[model samples]
Target: MYIGRAVIAGYTNEKKVFLGYILASMSFPKRRARIDEESIKIEPLKTADYNNPYITYNCMKKVEKDKAVVSNGIHTDVIANKLDSGYSGRDAIAISLFAMDYEKDEYNTPRIAACFDNRSLYIGIIEKEKIIIDKVRNDRCMLISTYNKTVPEEISIKRSTAKDIAKELCMLDYEHIICSAVVCRREENDFEFATEEKNRL
Candidate 1:
């Protein structure tokens, strides 16, 4: 019932990608969110996932506008810094992931991440020494999680809408899932962002 924490990134338009996260799960988090002029925060409800998750993290760091780094731990910052420093999306993800390797938990939980820049989306998982990274185009979605060692994949969906991915986990009859997905698009000179969430009762 524990999938740790994760993010899913995908293209919603020619110039923007939707980035969404799974709030801490399995247990209802006394979750609180704050959105101000400069930032947005979702208090983490997971104290220990695989290895004192609070120590590492399943956090996201928004790099320069148009790019973001999402990972299952502290590496999120590492990846974001890289992107901010001008590294290509793939390189940022790879370099940061390789630097952290995998969490040294009893289960050897893999670190999952997804990143996107102006027009592309990337997903990856680091497990011990094996790493899988893929560049997913704007029209489809790829799935990954931080649980036991397992391969992640890209799957097709009937509706490639914002409401779609948010329902993924909760629809499984899984009680510990808090999911959200974004649907973004770029109009003539601006970007549009739409999001949706589904939390288990």
Candidate 2:
């Protein structure tokens, strides 16, 4: 039951599509950052930080102005590149996850991600089987993570600033929480995405 990474999306009263994530890792270190103008990267820090494992390595890449690929491992780059090459969020997520299959790590961790923008939200998971929630409507967010639970795993966050939600996730008892990123489409007409990130440190 290792659901160390997750994505959330839904609409607020302002009519904005919001996407958020919590990267949890009890085994490896994590860092949250915006590496460049478009890409916001979050991953396990290297020996550069401390001894770590490739099994837990991960990253986030911006697929477009509004869309981003947040994943449990290098698969983030794989999916993000496809998006940069002009694939729609759906096709890019499918093609990338289909090719990579699941992580071959000893844990056999599933590969999971989200393709999120102002107008749409998609969640993709790859394990023994694959499931893609192509579009999560405003009524509620469709959330799936690395491990499947017998009970429903989805939870709702009260509409608030990005930092508020991230902090709320940190308050959870789950010992694996590494960091969180919250992206909201505040601009109604076009893509004007604003994000806030906080590392477990």
Counted clashes in each candidate structure: 1, 2
Candidate 1, residues 1-201: lDDT per residue as tens digits?
Answer: 565565566653342455555654554354432232222244544553342444334355555556665665677778878887888888888898898888886667677888775556888888886898888876765667776424665544433344554455335443455544333334322333333345332
Per-candidate TM-scores read 0.71, 0.76
Error of model 1, residue 14, in angstroms: 8.9
Worst lDDT 10-window in candidate 2: 189-198
Top lDDT model:
2
- Backbone clash pairs for candidate 1 read 57-73
* Model 2 local distance difference test score: 0.60
Root-mean-square deviation (CA) per prediction: 4.5, 3.7
